[model samples]
Target: MNIALVTGSGGLIGSEAVSFFADKFDLIIGIDNNMRQYFFGPEASTQWNQDRLASDFATYEHHTADIREVSQLEPIFQKYGTDIKLVLHTAAQPSHDWAAREPFTDFGVNAVGTLNMLEMTRLHAPQAVFVFTSTNKVYGDNPNFLPLIETETRWEIDTNHPYYKNGIDEYMSLDHTKHSVFGASKVAADIMVQEYGRYFGMNTGVFRGGCLTGPNHSGAQLHGFLSYLMKCAITGTQYTIFGYKGKQVRDNIHSWDLVNMFWHFYQNPRPGEVYNAGGGRYANCSMLEAMALCEEISGNKMNYQYSETNRSGDHIWYISDLSRFKEHYPTWDWTYDLRSTMTQIHDSMIERLAVTQ
Candidate 1:
């Protein structure tokens, strides 16, 4: 039986993976403990998404297991063994701000949790295609050092820079900058994932994502940039923009689009290959630009405040260069652009809010 195992199975990306691969894989095994709630409070809890998955897909077997606990993960891997064909490790302490509050917890989840998964995969389903959802933070503040031009509403790379047309690529250095507590832990996990694949000759692909967003995301103040911003717009909650004069930019990729990249990679396995994945130029926006789009879509003038201080290790401007991933999987391309994606988030939030109300 072809089984797919998804860690953080209730998250924006993990749940998307389950839904996307439900028809393709025989059984979908999920491990998520709703750690997001702990990381960003009750509003960020993914339990609702978990419940939705259970209701939607019978083939999806849910486990409220913490990836940080090796004992909790071992039995699941052992039970399925080689039958598990795809291991999607998406669980992590996602916010750098929160990471500073507890460095041990952050390292335990992001770095140690990844090590556990890799070791388990190595011992059990050595042949399974392991896909890790790494972060752009791995590049640290290195991207900030680039020659960036500030526009009226957004920050853009210099037109003459090689990264202007496409965006930042994997070749960007991952060193000598403030990575924050969260980025440091992710870098540890990121490099380890690569090492496992290269050293073990296991098929592992690392995708460094920008802002991964969707309706399913349990948007919070600390993370889930677009989702939270949209939520605030719909609910009349005041949103805060930090530093770079709210011109900080990020590429936002829909969850389905990213999971599709995982599907393409799983179809044709590559060992230790890393790809920068995001909306690219096709679906990117600055903070101010995104706020405007949210207001446009929700028809609500968002209550927002700007802060002079920026989040530590935050990118002033970043858009993933899809050239490498596209070159590798020419068959795959982005289906959701920025406007459409935000519209989906707006509509979905409205439906969900109505239900709750």
Candidate 2:
């Protein structure tokens, strides 16, 4: 039986992977312990998405297991053995603020948990393509050092800077910056994923994602930027804009587009290859711009307040340069732009809220 293993199976990206690859793999094994609840709160629980996955796909097999525990993770890998064709490692303690509250949990989940997955693959399915959804936080606050010009609504790179035309690329240095506890842990895992591929000659790829968002996300104030922003807009929740005069920018990539990129890499099987994944020049926005867009789409005025202190290590302006990934996989292109993505999230949130009410 061909098995595709997805960690964080109930997450925004993981659920997308399960849906996208269900037909390709004979069995989809998902490993998740609903730790989002542990990391954030009861409201951030992903049990809802897990139930949806179980109901929606016949081939999907859900395992409530934490990636940090090797024993719990190994049995599944042993069961599938060589039939495990793909491993999508998306499970993470994904918030910088939350990480400070519990550094051990953050490092254990983000760094050690990744090691467990990598070793399991190496032992049971050496040839399986391992895709890690790493974050641009792996670059830390390095991007903030770029020459930037602040406009009325957003921060823009200086016209003369090399990154101005396409935004930050993989070539940017990953050192000498404040990475936050969350970013630091991700850096450890990111390098390990690369080493597993290059040193051990396994098929592994790291996607340094900017703002990976979709309707499926259990959006919380700590993470899931676009989804949470739209939720606030729809629910009339007071959203706080921290730092950069609320003009900090980020590139947003829909879950479908990112998972499609994974599919391409899985098919081609690149080893130790890294790519900066985001909406690129196609879809990006500042906090102020995103708020306006959400209001326009939801037809509700966003309740927001500005705070002078920005989150530590947050980027002022970050648009991913997809040139490397595009050059490698020319067939892949974005299907959802900013407006479409926000609209979809708005609709999904409305449907979900309606169900609960």
- State every prediction's TM-score relative to the real structure: 0.99, 0.99
lDDT of 1 by residue, 31-80 (tens): 99998998888888888899999999999999989888889999999999
Local distance difference test values of all predictions, in order: 0.94, 0.94
Scored against the true structure, residue 306 in model 2 reaches a CA lDDT of 89
lDDT of 1 at 320: 95
> What are the runs in model 1 whose C-alpha is more than 4 Å off?
none
Residue-level lDDT of model 2, residues 40-115, one tens digit each, is 7876889999999999999999999989999999899888899999999999999999999999999999999999
